[model samples]
Target: MTILSYADSALSLLPPVVAIMMAIVTRRVLLSLGMGILLGAVLINDFSVIASGQYLGEQVAGLFWDDGAVNAWNMYLLGFLVLLGMITSLITVSGAASAFADWARNYIKCKRDAKLLTMFLGCVIFIDDYFNSLVVGSVARPLTDRYYVSRSKLAYILDSTAAPICVISPVSSWGAYIIALIGGILTAHGFTDSGHLSVFIQMIPMNFYAIFALLLLLCVIFWDLNVGPMRQHELNAQKGNLYDEAKGLPPGANSDLPEAKNGKILGLFLPIIVLVLATFYFMVSSGGDVLAADGKPFSILGAFEHTDVASSLFFGALVGFIATLALVLIQGLDKLYLTKGLVAGARSMLPAIYILLFAWTIAGVIGQLETGKYMASLASGNIPFALLPAVLFVLAGLTAFSTGTSWGTFGIMLPIAADMAMGTHTNMMLPMLAAVLAGAVFGDHCSPISDTTILSSTGANCHHIDHVITQLPYALIVAGISLGGYIVLGFTESLMAGLATCSILFVISILVLKFKSTQAIS
Candidate 1:
């Protein structure tokens, strides 16, 4: 088969799985992604070489410099990584993180409560997943640690809430991406009468994966139902078997550190509030549009035309840094100490920043090789109409898992799913799209190289590997339930029925958990 034919044939399943296995075994995410991209590019190039009698190097160069490659590199992933570094750097330098940590430590006394609060905060800040991951992890890790909540658990909660919440919320960066993808599919299918924003609003409820994941996260928090690997980790943690089991030196060690006290805890709150409010103001002012106003009805979309993940984080982080500085100076903090605190915070985030860059580069390479599109095309031919939602969910999951990015997965899946829905004459668009978001989140939640996963580990002061191991079970359970829900909804086309079934299952699960807890207590 030709390269395009093979890529259109089987690159998705084989290459991504190969990449993931390589990453896990080598423990080098970037290397694995690089290999995956190389394999994909080689497959395409070799096929062309065999068919056209061209040199492999020439074909590879042409493919790499294609418009698609340039767009993938310059537009989506590169800018996103730079913005991630800047925002994360600002968060650390401002001493806003320390302030938030101290305040949460003083107020939240229980491990479960701390986890729940983190989840709630994640829901509230649905504008950007990168912002959500960095802010929530930075602020909540300290509080969660004091209560003996495992670092793994904290990472899980943070990962669970970040992308899943934002993708469903109309005000977030994920929302805008979905709308754009959906608009393209809609226009292609002669559904231009329905505005992109309007269609997104209508689809929110049908997104089974996002809805179920949030609900399940709440269950884990309030109900304390730790099944599968999460349960084992929790048991081991309680038994003092977790990594670095020894209780470190006194808690005051951190407190007494000059850098820790550089800024009052309240200082962190101010910048976060400003960033959040600014995001909301812009989102609403633009009518969830990505463009600036120009007297056109859709002028709002123009405002966000230049808005990428990096741009949003840049503005928010800048405001946060200024707020942190002003608050520290006003409180008569020593200038040296303040600078030291900021430096400390930045140092703390270094690991996460490295992980983010690697994750982005990997995703970029996958796009360059067209791995995801190949996978999507392969599945399109064989998918049964009744199984469309499940197929989409799985495809989205694999894409995010391989790429270590939920946003990229959604960008790849939404348009294809929408087009499939129209072609099949099935009303499965909303549910399928929801599955895309949910599946992407599930994979990103567990993938060790994921930015949110790294941030969750950083926030919780947990080892990154520990977080990935413990968080996997919880993510899978939610995915299992979401798959079932999507299947039901796909057949019935009844959103209400699907929700009811999920609710009943959730309630039963809670009851079972409570009974099991009572038995253990007895």
Candidate 2:
């Protein structure tokens, strides 16, 4: 098959649009993604049935096997999901989760405390979005459930905090990846005065959407700002219903698992602590290996830049699984019950795994179609200097939303934004780059197909579509505020002005929600 270019054409946009629309309308994610994948294959192969079939086969095969070997990244991620499911199941069956909830009830008195604790944990677990999304829910769910905090609300907090914190934290995987990209972009654009790390630090304040999203989540928790679909979820939670049971149990929840009467709280925290430590250890050690192979002295940042995240996560989860099993054995659980827990745990993760595989496959198909390239091309033309940052923000958001990957959006748009800024808005490079980062995160928050989004739902044990629908309004509000900030920054050429605008708008939005809640109460 010959390589074709959809880089310059709008046809590249069709697949994701069709997929997103179908997903929203029919609520069938796998089917929608499959349709999009097939459409992309047909279009990419110029409507040849044989070519399309072969291309689709190769794409799916390539996800698992690359260059005649296993695709370590995808396989490792799948492995981690399975291990996490088992850990969750083991924790529940061992009665660790129940004990922890009981222990927490002493310190956490109300629903507000439960939600705030969830948000706090979300911020604390900031190393990797996947880790944060999966771990925080497992830790906080019991407490939240004790207070009847809706599963959708928990999912929202997990989703909001996961990527936003990772994007801003210099020590996180997201930060390392973005900084590496920024380093290349800066070099390419003849910028040598500032280190990528310093530039990343400077851009933090300009990452308006990320900062605002976290703030919005805080306000939602503090002031009870459950607007849109989330309000219904909250009301139901207050009525002692965490979710619509008719929709069935969410992933990672196994009702068949038996709980031990004498389960210790240590059973819960021990494995989680081990998982976090082991993952961090593996990440750094793996990075050290890469640095040694390159003949470079080991540095924290250098190691992060070269770390094998997938392998690190898999090994960490594997270690955590061992810890969970040991705890169960320590409690004198029989082998039969242990086997039952393992089977139930693995069974619960199958739905999420299926959705994830299809999401990855469709993302690959969209990449082949050059969807991001087409979107980026639309913004390459001349634009008013005052609108450049805003344009880049919107463009980056659109790319990420359509393709469902923030990192992919960064790869496709960061260089373009860097070049455009250096060429036109020379002094506004940092703000422009920050806009791209903010936009990518904003888009990821709203994208139902995003891996982090799926994981958040799984971790919270919330229905995926319920999470998507309930979270959309909150994401949009912050996005709107961030867009306004970017537009102001572009026009005024002042970061402070933009920051002030966002801060004031956020406060006002919270107040408005408060007023509305008060009126509803009356």
> Which candidate leads the pack in TM-score?
2
lDDT of 2 by residue, 162-251 (tens): 999999998889999999999988888888787989989999999999999998998889888888889899899989889888877777
Q: Residue 127 CA error for candidate 1 (Å)?
A: 0.8
- Alpha-carbon lDDT of model 1: 0.64
Listed in order, each prediction's TM-score against the native is 0.79, 0.98
lDDT of all predictions: 0.64, 0.90
lDDT for position 53 in model 2? 91
Q: How good is model 2 by TM-score?
A: 0.98
Candidate 2: segments with Cα more than 4 A from true spot: none
Model 2 lDDT on a 0 to 1 scale: 0.90
